[model samples]
Target: MAEVKASMAGNVWKLMVSEGDSVDASQDVVILESMKMEIPIAAEVSGTVKELKVKEEDFVNEGDVIAVVE
Candidate 1:
């Protein structure tokens, strides 16, 4: 399994993939808003998304697991 983690503290701006969705390596899974900028978090491995740990507008800290792919 691969964990998609938040790179910085921010509010989740959008979710690009849902649970059970297929994702490719380096595909953006979530977008975070911080400091008026949008930061995209990508999947590091190609697989199906097993879980979505955060939803849109949810706050997350750096290193928080945003999704699980496997």
Candidate 2:
């Protein structure tokens, strides 16, 4: 399983993929808003999304696990 982690502290602006969605490496799975900017959190590997750890508008810290893929 691959854990999708936050690169910086931010609020989850949007969830681009839901659980069970198929994704390719480097696909943007979530959007984060920080410092008045929108940042995309990308998948590092091709796989199906197993779980979503954060919901839209949720606050997340740097290194927080946002999702799990398998």
Candidate 3:
């Protein structure tokens, strides 16, 4: 399994993939809003999304796990 982590502290703006969705390495799975900018968080490995550790509008810190893939 792979854990997708936040690259920076931010509010989760949107979710691009849901549970059971397939994702590729480097695929953008979530958008985070911070510092008046939108940042996309990508999956680190190709796999099916197993869980979402965060929800839209939730705040996350840098390096926080946002999703799990397997």
Find the candidate with the highest lDDT and give its number. Answer: 3
lDDT by residue (1-70, candidate 1, tens digit) is: 9899999999999999999999999999999999999999999999999999999999999999999999
Q: After superposition, how far is residue 57 of candidate 1 from its true place, in Å?
A: 0.5
CA-lDDT, candidates in order: 0.97, 0.98, 0.98
Residue 50 error for model 3, in Å?
0.2
- Which lDDT tens digits does candidate 3 get at residues 1-70? 9999999999999999999999999999999999999999999999999999999999999999999999
Candidate 1 Cα misplacement greater than 4 A, ranges: none
Candidate 3 local distance difference test against the native: 0.98
What's model 2's overall lDDT? 0.98
For each candidate, C-alpha RMSD in Å? 0.3, 0.4, 0.4
Residue by residue across 1-70, what tens digits does model 2's lDDT show? 9999999999999999999999999999999999999999999999999999999999999999999999
Model 3 ranges with Cα > 4 A deviation: none
Quote the positional error of residue 42 for candidate 1 in Å.
0.2
lDDT: worst 10-residue window of model 3: 35-44
Error of 2 at 67 (Å): 0.5
